[model samples]
Target: MPSDSALPQEDLAVRLRDGDADALAAVYERHSRLVHTLALRALGNHHDAEDVTQQVFVAAWRGRHNLDPGQGPLAAWLVGITRHAVADLLAQRARTVRNLHAVAAQPAEPATASLDGAVTDRVVVAHALASLGEPRATILKLAFAEEQTHEEIARRLDLPLGTVKSHIRRGLLQLRENIRGVRADAS
Candidate 1:
């Protein structure tokens, strides 16, 4: 009997349908390059293309019983599957972008939750600010609570202007993460 690679495409498709693992390997070796190339062309990123290539083969193996040799070439069916995989990846990327944008579009106020008569929200924000530690917590308090300018804070803290600015930046980020975590848990 011929090796899997030596068999005709239709015979390989049939063998693959019958659950022959060697046929799956043979199918991959013949078509992976084509799949990867198509994916790369559509995605324009080598890493994403490689991921889509792997997704195609995995999907192909999982759906092997669906192959119908009489309909067309196995290569063509693989091409169709590749197109679908690429579309799914692109859609996922779009959703991620939209989610990121939604997060960014939130109100610029430091804490919307603070505007209410809720001491709980104020306590949460204070706890988040305190958790920042040392110069960061102090820097944030001096900047926001005292309404001091960055230059004023630098002069008062005896730190470099840049160091004061760095502390404030990092402190705000950590506080945001902490507060967001609290909000998520509350909801």
Candidate 2:
């Protein structure tokens, strides 16, 4: 009997279908370089080409029973499988790139959470200021929010300088107490 390599292509394919490991080895030896070269050309990287080469042979071995030796050449069928394997690798690489871009495009989650917390704090402070009521709220808004000097606030509100200063100092203390209470309740 001829060695596996010495057998004609159709006989080898038949032997491969019959579960002859030697025939598969012989086939790999005969055409693996062709598959590897094709993969390298398509993928443009050595590591990826080597991986695709391994995948092609493994897939071919698993699907060996499907080979129709009389219909065509084994080399052609293997090349067809190589094309599919290269395409799969390319698609996998594309998906990885897309996932990386998606992650990069998103704002950092902690920063977003912190911004929301800051906005909430400002809202809470505003509500607390509103709760102050009367001349105190109006005086504080002019002194702090409107960024007026004590003299400017006194002049704007038509109050004495000492009265304006007193209202501002008392309003600040009340706001600090209100914020502390709110925070304590939240915790």
Identify the leading candidate in terms of lDDT.
1
Model 1 local distance difference test score? 0.87
Model 1: lowest-lDDT 10 consecutive positions: 108-117
Candidate number with greatest TM-score:
1
Report the number of clashing residue pairs per model.
Answer: 0, 0
- Candidate 2 Cα lDDT to native: 0.86
Model 1, residue 132: what's the lDDT?
A: 90
What is the Cα-based TM-score of model 2? 0.58
- Local accuracy of candidate 1 as per-residue lDDT tens digits, 1-187: 9987899999999988888888989999999999999999999977678778888988998998899988999999999999999998888779757866987998766655455637787899989988999989999998999999888998998986757866876787789899999999989
> What TM-score, computed on C-alpha atoms, does each candidate reach?
0.62, 0.58
Where does candidate 2 have its weakest 10-residue lDDT segment?
107-116
